[model samples]
Structure formats: structure tokens, C-alpha cells
Target: MPTVNDVEWDLVGISEIRWMLGGLSRQRTNVIANTKGFPDPIAELEMGKVWLRRDVEAWIRDNRPELLENKKGPTPE
Candidate 1:
């Protein structure tokens, strides 16, 4: 099994998700985040919630392919 250090990490929070979803409003992002098919957050932290970037990207790829097609540039870190 992969150890913690061996695993690649690309975690994202609400703001990042907003950007990934093409600058969606916070309310819209929250709604989508709570949607039934959305990926469960990997953790809920003091700041907010976080998800694996890969998982969010996958969900976007499947559900909102047009967003990816119109991506302005690389996602911010």
C-alpha cells in the first residue's frame, strides 16, 4: 500500500473549486458541493473543507466537460 509520503497530494478548498468551476459564486459552489453526485470531501478542516484535486477534476470532467474546454489556464495553487 502507498504510504502518506508516497501519495501525491493536490488538495483544493472552496475557493479553488469555485475557480475550477469557472469562477462560480460561493453559493453556487456550495450548492454543487452538496449535490448528490459530488465527491465527498477528504476532510473538513478549521478553515473549511478540502477535496483531492484529482477527484474534483474527475467530477468536472464527467459532469462539466465544457468548463475544462474553456479553462483559461492552469488552476492556481
Candidate 2:
């Protein structure tokens, strides 16, 4: 049987998609319209911008270059 290592991270299955959408499901950009602002949390976590598909985390890391070059720990004011 295939394990986690065998599955490509980018080839998300229906079950994987459902799990990822769980967080997006609760977000309410406009509750009146039954609207949702999906991917916002991921954007917030990554930086002010969100990562598109394809490069995924690499795209986010590139967008927030400081995060990559940081010295770790908190910065001094």
C-alpha cells in the first residue's frame, strides 16, 4: 500500500481537498450572501499576500523574502 511519502503533496485528493477547505469553510467575508473568503488565513500566515497553486510554499517564501533571510527570533524595534 502507498504511504504519505509515496503521495505527491501537490496532487491533493478529494479527501485532502476537503480537509484543507475545512478551515476556509468557516471564514465569513459576507455572511449575508453566503460568501466565503477562502485562502485568507493562509495569506495571513504567509504574509500580506497569498500563494497561488504551482509553486505553493515556494511562491509564498519568495513573496515574503524577509521570512527566508531572517536571523530567527524577534527583531529589535
User: Which candidate ranks first by lDDT, i.e. highest?
Assistant: 1
Per-residue lDDT tens digits for candidate 1, residues 1-77, read 44569757789999999999999999999999999999998889999999989989999999999998786676779
lDDT minimum window of 10 residues, candidate 1: 1-10
Task: For residue 42, give model 2's deviation from the true position in Å.
Answer: 14
TM-score (C-alpha) between model 1 and the true structure: 0.84
In model 1, where do residues sit more than 4 Å from their true spots? 1-3, 72-77
lDDT (0-100) at residue 4 of candidate 1?
68
Question: Candidate 2 — number of clashing residue pairs?
Answer: 0
Taking the tens digit of each residue's C-alpha lDDT, what string does model 2 give over 1-77?
Answer: 33567544343222333333332232331231132332222232322333233333353254445544553667789
Q: Which regions in candidate 2 have their CA more than 4 angstroms from the true location?
A: 1-7, 10-54, 71-77
Candidate 1: the clashing residue pairs are: none
**Residue 73 in model 1: lDDT:** 77
Worst 10 residues of 2 by lDDT: 26-35
